[model samples]
Structure formats: C-alpha cells, structure tokens
Target: MPVEQAESLLASQFSIQHTYYRQHYPHGRFDIIMQGTKNIGRLYHDWSGDVVQLIDIALLSAYRGAGIGTRLMRAIVTEAARKHMRMQLYVEFDNPVRALYRTLGFAPAGENGIYELMHRDAMPFDEEAWASVRGLNNPFQ
Candidate 1:
C-alpha cells in the first residue's frame, strides 16, 4: 500500500492521535493487517526494508496461554521464508514476548531504551542478500 493509504487505515485501526503522530514521526507511517483472517495477525512494514511486523496479536481473554502467540509467530515465520524477507519488530528487554522472538530466531540488531531491534532470516543474509534485504549491513562490505 502507498504510504498515504496505509497511514489512513492505521490512523483509525491503531487509534493514532495526531499529537503522538506529529511528535514521534513527523515524516511517515505504515501498513497494518492481520493473518488470513484467522484472527492470527500481521503488520507489513517498509522502514527502508521489507518486513512483516507483529502487532496487537490478540487472543481471547480466556485463551491466554494455549500457545496462540507461538502459533501465530510460526505462521509469520513460514510466510517470511517464502517472501524472502525477514521479520523485524521491537520488544522491551523484559517483555515476555522477547523470549518468544528469541525462540522464533530473532536477534538484537540495535536498541531503543528498553526495546530492541530484532530480526529473523533462516540464513543471515550474505553479502548479496544483505544488499537486497534492507540496504544497510555494509559493515565495511
């Protein structure tokens, strides 16, 4: 989706307030969606790279620990491999969800206070793949 269209949808879906929007990101926004309408969810992000972001993954109030989060993550992982893009997201160091991301193969690439920049690609991108992956990774390449 175009940046304008995505922000338009998330403006309501994410209940984004104008103040927060202007203060935090004066430049851009994102595209949000869920998994297959199975209640499993996914958010697509293009922050200089292609990634499927996880957001507001909700389980019924009574379904807190029947492995829902894990299942949803795995689904995203499977899809990611085919798309040939990685999964990226932020999680506070103490967030229980951080453990889950580790389980699904994400590693800390950078940080923001208590949060981390995490990503997963079965094969950590090589010189070529990395160049195409997100356009960063030059680490003197």
Candidate 2:
C-alpha cells in the first residue's frame, strides 16, 4: 500500500477505536498531558465505578523517565485513597511503567492475553506523602 494510504487507514482505525471507547465508557475522562505550552501525552481514566480505573496514560518519548508519570500516578493514588476507592489498571506484560505502578502499590491482580491487570486496595490518606508527591516540598516539582 502507498505510504499515504496506509497512514490514512491507521488514522481512521484509531478514530474508530477512540469513538468506541467514548461510547462504551461515557463517564471516562480523557486529558492531554501538557508541559508548559507543548502537548506531552495523554491520560484517560474512569472513576465512576467502585474502582478507579486508569484506562491509559502515555508520555512523549522526550518526557519519559523524568518522574512525570510517577507524580501523576501518585496524585491519582492519593485521590483514590481519599475517596476510599480501589484502583485498577491494565498494563502490557512488557511495559516498563508496570514497575512504577508497582512502586505506587499496584499488584498484579489478573491477566488477559498480553495485559496484566494491576490492582491497589484503597489506602488511608497520608497528608505528608500527598503533599510531597504533589510537589509541595518535592524536588520533582
């Protein structure tokens, strides 16, 4: 196939998938991750159920490994803890971000094909930790 045609086909497929997700998870949120004025990545999640589900999160190659993902995950963990809600997400078996999720207290709950489901029970809120992760006194800020 011509390069242009292949690109168009892929783009349309992605659009279809995105639309399907939106319709399936009507309460899900999709946020663009930004740094200053540049778009760095995206975060998609749903908190409408008993469990806070982190559907997807990605950072640009230039923005990875800089603790941005850690901070974001921490924030979500803190909020879920505050609400006493369990958290869950699916990570590809080979995705390095699984380590970060493990560090944030998520453990392998199950598996489906190439994706491993990670779960973290609701935790007690810790103000100091939340503050630090939020850059209150954290160097990453």
Q: Which candidate is the best by lDDT?
A: 2
Write the residue-wise lDDT of candidate 1 on 12-115 in tens digits: 76565544544544442433222334332323333234665543344444545756556545655655665677777777788787787787688888999987
**CA lDDT of each candidate?**
0.54, 0.81
Candidate 1 segments exceeding 4 Å error: 1-14, 17-49, 122-141
Model 2 regions lying over 4 Å from their true place: 1-10, 125-141
What count of clashes does model 1 give?
A: 1
Report, for all candidates in order, the number of backbone clashes: 1, 0
The digit string of per-residue lDDT tens for model 2 on 1-141 reads 999999999899868867976997789887877766678877788999999988878888998988877777787788889889999999999998889888888999999999999999998655455664432222122
What's the TM-score of each model vs. the native? 0.53, 0.81
